[model samples]
Target: MTDAARDLISKAMVDAGDPVEFAAYAPSNIALSKYWGKRDRSRNLPLNSSLSISLAEWGSHTEVAPSESGIDQVSLNGEVLDMGTAFASKALKFADLFRAGRAQPLKITTRNTIPTAAGLASSASGFAALTRALCGSFSLSLSEAEMSLIARLGSGSATRSIWHGFVRWDKGRAEDGSDSFATPLDVTWPDFRIAIIPVDVGPKSHSSRDGMNHTVDTSPLFAAWPDQAEADCDFIEAMVREQNFTALGQRAEANALAMHATMQAARPAITYLTQDSWAILERLWAARKNGLEAYATMDAGANVKLIFEAQSQDDVTTLFPEAQVIVPFAG
Candidate 1:
């Protein structure tokens, strides 16, 4: 363990019970202005300000407890993971954050309502719930911003998932990353709804982190992304505050396309879109051209999420009956 982990572990406290447990639930978020690159990988700090909305119906419930053995254990959806794996390492690191001593091993259990590692922000919800549970166990009285800071250490997008409604993650200037955290916009639009269309159910061929790093290192189009993202967020925040769904959807779609364009220009040319994804995009365009309001945004996976007014929801569902899942915006 690193010295930092050791310091945190040294401060852990426990009761007389043989096992002490903490559990929490956090929802996944869909980024309107995507965070495609990291300025500081060690801190999981983003290269630009990104905005997202937390999905109320999709989330993860995570629990952490003292283990009987001396080694850390992680179980996700009842499947035990090898400790030498990266996922398990991350879970163990989170468990270590709540340790009062080096000998205190932990067993972590996480259950996700949504699919994991398919570019739907599963890591975001998982890490956020894990961070919340571990902090609660330690009785740490951290604010939402402080909790976000801890969550970002595991996944950058997870910082935004810590809040409800619209969230904006600031790409802070501090080297230690104290200023880089998420803040809720404190506004909700009841008329706004999101319908998720899953085009690819399998895990992404390239991890989002690796794809982002590749784009940052090799894509020439990356130079303009941060400024574009900032402008998009400014407009998105304004439109969201005014409840202007038309303008909000338009900017969100444009931002997602621009982010993907950068990835396409990377040396390895990472493209997450499938033929079905393009077909769905064509249908979204047709819906708009036909005078029905709809806009689409895609992450690092083939799934397409459509944003439209509540009244047009049935139309969207009819347009994509093959949708793997349809969920409304819950903030």
Candidate 2:
């Protein structure tokens, strides 16, 4: 860990001994203004601010407790994971931030309600819920914002997963990332909806982290991304605040395409969208021209997610029968 990260943990941890069982749940989120690249990888600080809407009831549930076996353990979806497994190893390493060289073993169990590693922001909810559970288990007195800061150490998108509804993560100016954290946006449109059109639900061929680093290092077009993304985020936020669905959807779709354009400009070119994905977008465009009100965004995977209001639910479903519609703010 970096000195900045260690110091943050040391300052926030009120107690790190005699841990008790603690559990937490965090909602998965889809970025409206995507967080593609990181400025500080160690701290998971972003190059530009981003906005997202949480997927209600679709997330992760994590539990942390003292290991009775006197060794660290991790499980996902009730299946015990070998310590050498990627998820298990990362979880234990994150726990080490609290242990701080101490020999306190922990048992971490996480169950994700959404598809893992398929571009649905599963890591975001996983880390956010783990952060909450670890803080509770270790007896940390940090507030939600403080928790968000700590969670960023695990995943940049995790910073926004700390809350439900609309959230924005500010890419702060601090070198140590002290000011970088996410806060819930005050606006709430109950009619807002998201529909997932899954293309490949399996683990992505390339992780978003690796894809981001590669794009940043090799994509010449990335030079223009930070500024353009910041502008897009600002505009999207304004449209969101005004509840202007048309403006918000247009900018969001444009921002997503712009992000993918950068990835395509990489040295070898990383294309996450498959031919089927483009077909969906083509169909969506045709429907939009015909007066269907919805917009689409994609991440580091082939799946496409659409944003629309409740009024367009029937039309969206009829157009994309396989789409899984989710009411983001439903009770």
Candidate 3:
């Protein structure tokens, strides 16, 4: 959890006499493209646009409950959090929406499905669940776009979780980040499953947050993220219109890794690319290297998720038998 929210949740606890508990969920996903470096840092808005699909099989779930008497309480997979402070931090971001005219406090509790130190995007799922649970508990019915804005205040990548299938995160032109919300794409999910294989490399070398920060502060390629992100967005629109699996597969694989390339050129020239990460990529490349059309994409961390037709499940399973494949059930 972000420290600013953690502190606020703690303060809310002292003032509120009561708090309740409820369950929330944060689903895992692979960025077919990527969501990186924020344009508006305070709001955690992105510098470039991105597209992704929510992975139904490999994600996180959280629980948030607030009492009728006072503030709320939170727990993730059974561990209680400083609900008041957490909620207060989140609540503050949207003071206009929740408070209406004055200041108020809230409590939030959450848990993550991804490994704590690994590069998998638990924050995206975590923030997504937080937004959903908080909106429900507060009796506030925010539209998907509105919810995405709230999620952005929590984390930039989180904005994508507002939808189930194909989604886009746009980098708006406003300082307030009103334009930086997620829009759903046309890829129907549950038909496609993701294989998330984390290469064990003594844990992630650097966190996505730190990596993105490095990209923004130092990398010369950072200048290209926004323009290229918009181009990727255009490619996505075409992907949906054509539904060409081959184009979709190839475009996504290259774009995702390209988004991460900035970190490689950062100040210290550090990279999270380990042997296992490349091993998976190598296998994917080998498949494409042969004639079997398969594509893969990754997030900020070290995991490689293979994207292929459900019909090819057996073949994928056979090729990467060691990887954890999540076959989505039709929803």
Candidate 4:
């Protein structure tokens, strides 16, 4: 087994007894410096560090227990889901971690409030919640750092969702990926809110994982993403510490665009920005020009998340009538 697997097994100290069940809730996080590529595919380690804000209103609640049968049973939002697809892959990873060296199947039931394919951070929350639930059910007393490490194995972005408010996932250098985990930053600005605009509620044409893989393997622009993202993370972290809204918003927007540009330059040209998305982005630029403090960032989906103040909610709602305002989650 790999060192990563060994470390995980070392943490699984649950005694063999009656199956234990427990539930946990974890909120999704929007990346300020987008994590778009991987350094270690097997371990799901990122090429560069990223900073994110956990959403208060968007999250997932998961319940996990040992299954009597040998097969794993997974359910999401009251619907029984197949375990082979991309969606259930996180759950599968969770079960594998929960079982460790033991041959045990898991029954996982998860419910997510985050809208599917809305460009929100549902996978982050989903995996984090599942990991938390599994840890609780198995009575594994893992530190926050260890939990973040396990969460990263499920989904790269999920590492940051393990914490509340502003969090940063360091791009560690270990081949075993013992250090590639997220740390919660101090919440310097509590009023820093985001407006989640759902341009298209339908599923994304290309998954973030698939897009990142394509870009890393084929995109010429991918070469520079790591350095740029790292610098952006450093700058953004300082901006947060100083509570500089203007600099933070600007850096967030630039970092997101840089990540998307690499994806767009991939061999197959993985493009997630729609015409409506561009219109919304332009509106944010206009709002910023007009002193509205509105700055936008996007993930692998077409939806745009705008960073603004709670006092500017009226203007934000008026500009994007369908946008939903999300406050920073306190984990």
Highest TM-score: give the candidate number: 2
In model 1, what lDDT does residue 119 have?
Answer: 43
Q: Give per-residue lDDT, candidate 1, residue 12.
A: 39
Order the candidate numbers by TM-score, best to worst.
2, 4, 1, 3
lDDT of 2 by residue, 122-218 (tens): 7899999999999999888788988888889999999999999999999988888888899999988999999998787766768999999999999
Tens digit per residue, CA lDDT, model 1, 1-331 = 1332223333333332334688888888999888988887777878888888888858889887777786678988889998787778887776655564547677788898885433475889888898887776556656778778778878999999887778998888776777888999978677777778877778787889999999999999999998889899889988988888889999999999999999999887999988888999998898789988989899988989888887997888888886544343443
| Predictions in order: lDDT | 0.80, 0.90, 0.67, 0.83
- Give the top-scoring candidate (lDDT): 2
Candidate 1 — what's its lDDT? 0.80
lDDT of 4 at 308: 80
- Which is the winner by lDDT between candidate 1 and candidate 3? 1
Residue-level lDDT for 20 in candidate 3: 35
**Model 1: colliding residue pairs:** 12-100
RMSD of 3: 5.7
Per-residue accuracy of model 4 over 7-60 as CA lDDT, tens digit each: 764646645343488899988999988888898887898889999988876899
Looking at model 4, report the run of 10 residues with the lowest lDDT sum.
9-18
lDDT of 2: 0.90
Q: Once superposed on the true structure, which residue ranges of model 3 sit more than 4 Å away at CA?
A: 1-22, 67-73, 81-119
